[model samples]
Target: MFKNNNTCLAVFTGIIGVVFFSAKAVMVKLAYQYDVSPVNLLMFRMLFALPFYIVILFITRKKSEEHGLGVKDFIWLLFFGFIGYYLASYFDFLGLQYIKASIERVILFIYPTIVVILSAVFLKRKVGPVQILAIAITYVGVLVAFWDEFRIEGSEFLTGAGLIFLSALTYASYLTGSDFLIPKFGVLRFTSYAMIIACISVVTHCSLSEEASLSGYHANVYWLGLAMAFLSTVIPSFMVSYSIKEIGASNFSVLGSLGPVSTIILASIFLDEKFTILQMGGTIIVIFGVVVISLQKRRKHT
Candidate 1:
């Protein structure tokens, strides 16, 4: 019963996170007005987020069992952190520089499908036939949603698409890697370590790239940076790991599809980006796919 409660809570958090993270493209735009490089931008964002997530873990330490993270755990932790948070966010921000937030979000939404495929291939999990069809439907939706720019066109568009694809792959790998530790370390403990490690990795990357230095940015940009860190990075990171722990990856991915939809809605509001007919149709198809995925899981459990 307690587990079930956590599951519900985690899912709710993930949903809220979906909404929170959708503003990232906008945040990146606001930050760019200060002439900040993507790397420097990410450095400030992650650096600020580090303390916030750390404080939360410190306050709730009692809920988790502290374990010795020896060489093996740290090795895995560092790898996952690098790939999951550091690489994913870095590429995402860089990609956003060349693409509209609305387009970037729709592209990033492909990660859910990637997660499903990776789980089936690497985890050797059995997905129902209906689930397969649902995924196909979702893919169709994704293509339809992006038909405007998926064409063979400008190098900038191609680059944005490539970088976003990398973000999705790394993010998918991060999801898979988390599953490796959650069973042994418990969700919260593993999460606490993973985040701290990723923060370190980002710092290291910044130092090596000479992006560690902060300068030439106005005071106004700091607030936007904080909002990005807190809203997009820290909160969503915690919620995603928590949701993965509670509901399992597939269901989490089920909820994850809402991200692009949420991003679109947020774009509509803050970006004044109007929705196209194809995007609306794509959103409907994606939702239908998620429904099919969930129903398939229920059917299997029964």
Candidate 2:
């Protein structure tokens, strides 16, 4: 009974996390309408999100000492914080400037496949034939989605898709690294500390880049930033970490397939983005592939 309950909890958390995370692209696209640069937008997001992480740090500080993070742990946290949150988010924000939110979410959905491949290569985990099939199905879905976008948008789609693909790669790297560290540091502690590091990295980058002034934006942009900070950043971050803790990264990532669908729906409603039948079919295929992966993972564990 307890195991069943835990599974249910993980599923709920995963779904909610994916939904909120999906909102991020929509929110970023909306903020772009105000002429906010990606750097400035990311800076505002991290700035507003900074305090919540600090609070998490304080809450988890004492508990963290039970395991007692070492110099190496701190170093790893810093590295991943930069790669996972800072670099990935920067690339994603920049990419959203060029692509529709729906496309951006679908591209980002590839991270799970990236994570699976990275695990096999870097961690020496064996990828079975089933897993290989799952990966192929996922990519075919992505190609279908990409083809739809490319047909409508022309060659310009490549730039945004490439950037978002990079975002998925970096994010997958972060997840790969975190799989090792989350066991040592504990989920809440690791998430809080790593995000704090990401916050600092984002602030420093903004300071150096001079891309957009921090101040003097329309009040609406700041509000949108705050929404992104709370709705998309802090809440989803914790929920995802918790879900990973409960379900493991592979299963958690499979649940992330929902992200693209949620984003497409939200984009249609909020951003008035249109989707073709091919894109919709592609989204279904992607979800089906991911569901297959999730079922395989479950069977292996059971």
Candidate 3:
């Protein structure tokens, strides 16, 4: 929909979308400080989003009768939602509880590399030297930003790290698998349905395992948690889905490598975190790596 007649609009939209999404980390930190447990926090996040997702799905279905979702869509969407949103978000929140936000961010930044790797394997996409280099740079930047935060050895950190990476992998899988669905179903329709599914899944899990929904949270924390649902989940999910439709997943994913860079900047601003010279240098190197990978990919295509 951008008038640039180029995918640059998708790029810009994606960056903004992710930046908005990045704000959730601060929200999460705040929510946690206010004494919200992970399960209840995630439940609040999901249940609050449920009705909106349903209403959107209902509207989208009415408009596109011929292309309306069906059993198969539901099946795939269930898998997509449960794995992508439910499992991934749960793992992310849980990991964040155990790890520093900076370390958690670095772990999450690995998803772009996961996306590129999965694209190569599942989509048979060509990878070039530059693209590989870009992925390397991105990870290096993440390490730079988080190196001070991580002490480099232990079961707890390692397990948290693994879960964080698993969260990333699950999300990458969702992006790769659902790229086709974006074109087939439109972003709004696909995401509304999938998010509803994810919400329901999380709610069911919370009900079974947790004491209650939205318990022990201040009004501020509750509202911030809701903002997390809207900004982090709703907005970025829709924007990325649309971008995938416009530019294909690989390009979209390459752009996603910017997420950690943006996260570092946002954390410094909103969370009152200090931005050290090392973190800055790492981010710059990561940017260079991402450029290299992208150029390599382009050369391969050419």
Candidate 4:
């Protein structure tokens, strides 16, 4: 009974985390209406969220001291932070400029498949037949989703989709690398330290980029940025980490299959994004594929 209760709680946490994470693209699209540059928008996100991460560090300082983080860990954290949060987020923000939020979410949903492939190739993990089939099904769904966008927007759609795919790829790399580190540093501490490094990297990029500007945005943009920082960025980051800690990554990912569906619904209502039956079908297929992959992972572990 206790185990069952804990599983339910973990599932709830994972679903909530997925929902908030899914909202990020919608929030970014909303902010774009104010003509905010992606770099500046990203800077605002990291800046607004910085204080929370600092507080986390302060709270965990003693615990981290007991763990005794080495210089190499710091270096790796910086590296993963740059690839995961900084580059992945920058590309995602830039990609949202050209693509619909719904489409972006579907594309980003492919990260798990990418993670599987990366693990197989780099980590030398064995790829079972089930995993291969799952990967194929997921990409087929992505193609279905992409078809409509391509028909409507043509070449520009490709550019935006490409950027988002790159974002997913980098993010997958981050996940693969973090799998090794998370157990060492612990989830919250590692996430906080790595995110702080990513924040600094983002601020530096904003400072250097010619297009980056802080001033002259409408009030709503700032509000949305704040919403994204707390609700989407900080809260979901910790929730997903905790969910993984509790239920393990595979189970959390199975619950995270809700992400694309929630994004589509939110985008339709908030952004007034329209989708066809075909797109909806594709989304379902993608989610199904992801669930298969997640279940396969669970079976392997068990």
Candidate 5:
């Protein structure tokens, strides 16, 4: 009974996390209304998000020490932080400039399939027929939705889609590469460390880039940045981490299928982005493919 109760709680937590995470793009879209550059906006997010991660890191210091981390590991953490959070997030923010929030969410959701491909390439994981078929299904769905967006949004859609795809690719690389690091440092500690690295990276980049000034934004832009930082980044980060700890990563990942669906709804309600039949079909197909991969992972673990 207790186990079942914990699972139920984890499910609730995971769902909320997914919703808040999905809300990020909407918040970004809203912020863009003020003509803020992606780097400038992202700088605000990482800045607001920085303190919470610092607290987490301090709290987890003892646990982090238990793992005998070295200079080599820190270097890798820097790399992971740069590629995973910094680059991926910057690309995602830039992509949002040109694409609808709904389309960006769907494209980002394809990270699981990218993870499978990355694993097969780098980890020498065997790709069974089931995995291949799922990959095919996933990309076909992406293409269908992407083609529809292209028809309407024209040439700029390709640029946005390409940027979002790169965001997914880099994030997938992080997940694939960080498999060992998570176990060693623990999820929260490792995440905080990586996030700190990413925050520093963003700040430094902003300082160097003349176009990425942090001044002269409307108050709403700052408010939305705070919303993205807390609602989307810090709070959900901890919630999703707890959910994963309780219910396991595979289960947590399966629950992530709700992310794009929630994003679609949120985009429509908040951003006035239209919800079309093709988009719905594509989302369903993509979720189906991701579910297949997640289920396969569960089976392998069990």
Candidate 6:
């Protein structure tokens, strides 16, 4: 009974974490209204969130060193960190400029499919029939939702969709590579270190790019940045990690399917994005496909 209660609590935590993560899109859209450049906004996000990770790194300092990871490992961490958080985040923020938050979430949720394909291609892993079926279902849903946006939102929609797709691809690559290191460094330690590396990358890019200055935004922009750093990034990162520890990754992934649905509702409430039948239907299909993939993955592990 205690274990059951713990699982329930973890499930609840996972759901809340996913919802907070989804809110990132709405917040990004809000910040854009103040004419804040995407890179600058991303800089603000990392800047605000950096301290928390720093603290985590400090807390895990002993364990981090105990791993005995070599310079090569650190280099790989830097590479994946740059690819995952820095580049992926930049692309996501840039893409948000051209797409509605709802459509963007749906597009981003396809990262698992990307991961599957990447594993098959790069790792020489076989793509089973079940995986192929899940991938097919996922893309069909993506097309349904994307085509709906493309038809209504006109030509610019393609640009946004493409950027978001790039974001998903890079993030999937990060996951694929990180699989090798997580067991060595531990989740919290690895996450904190990688995020710090990503923070450095974002700051450097912003310093060199057109969005160098991070000043002159409205009070609300700074406030929203703080909110995103805590609510969306820092808090949910830890929460989801805890949830996965308690309930397992497979179950945690099931909760992830709610991400787009929550984003759709939040976008409607906050960003005034339209909530359409097509979007709901597409989201449902995507969830079904992702859940199947998640289950298949669990079966493999067992």
Top lDDT prediction, candidate number: 2
Q: Which ten residues in a row have the lowest lDDT in candidate 2?
A: 293-302
> Which segments of candidate 3 are over 4 A away from where they belong?
1-4, 66-73, 151-155, 288-302
Report the lDDT tens digits of candidate 2 across residue range 1-302: 56656666776887898899899999999898898999999999999999999998898788767455678887888898889999999999988888899889877988987888777787776667876777677667767755755557756678998999999999988987887788888888888877888899989888898575878888989999999999998998988888777766655667777788788789989999886687688778878876786666556555
lDDT of each: 0.75, 0.83, 0.75, 0.79, 0.79, 0.78
TM-score of 6: 0.83
lDDT of 1 by residue, 172-281 (tens): 88887786577766766677677777788878888899555677788867888888888887777777777787656656666666667777777777777677788888
Model 6 ranges with Cα > 4 A deviation? 1-16, 124-128, 141-147, 239-257, 290-302
Worst 10 residues of 1 by lDDT: 293-302
- Candidate 2 clash pair list: none
Give the distance in Å from residue 287's predicted Cα in candidate 4 to where it truly belongs: 4.9
Best by TM-score: 2
- lDDT digits (tens) for residues 1-302 of candidate 4: 56556656666777788899899999999999888889989999999999999999889888765366678877888898889888999899989988889888877877876777766787676666875676677667667755766466756788898999999888877777676677778878878977898899999998889988878899999998899999999998888777766654434444555677788789989999877787678778867876675555544445
In candidate 1, which residue pairs clash? none
- How big is the positional error of residue 44 in model 1, measured in Å on the Cα after superposition? 1.1
Instruction: Select the stronger candidate by lDDT from 2 and 4.
Output: 2
lDDT string for model 3 (192-291, tens) is 8788888988888887984665555589877977798887888787887787776667666766767777777877876777788888888888677655
TM-score on alpha carbons, each prediction: 0.87, 0.91, 0.88, 0.86, 0.83, 0.83
Look at candidate 3 and tell me the lDDT of residue 261.
Answer: 74
Q: After superposition, how far is residue 257 of candidate 6 from its true place, in Å?
A: 4.4
Extract clashing residue pairs from model 3: 130-292, 130-293, 130-296, 131-293, 134-289, 134-290, 134-293
lDDT of 3: 0.75
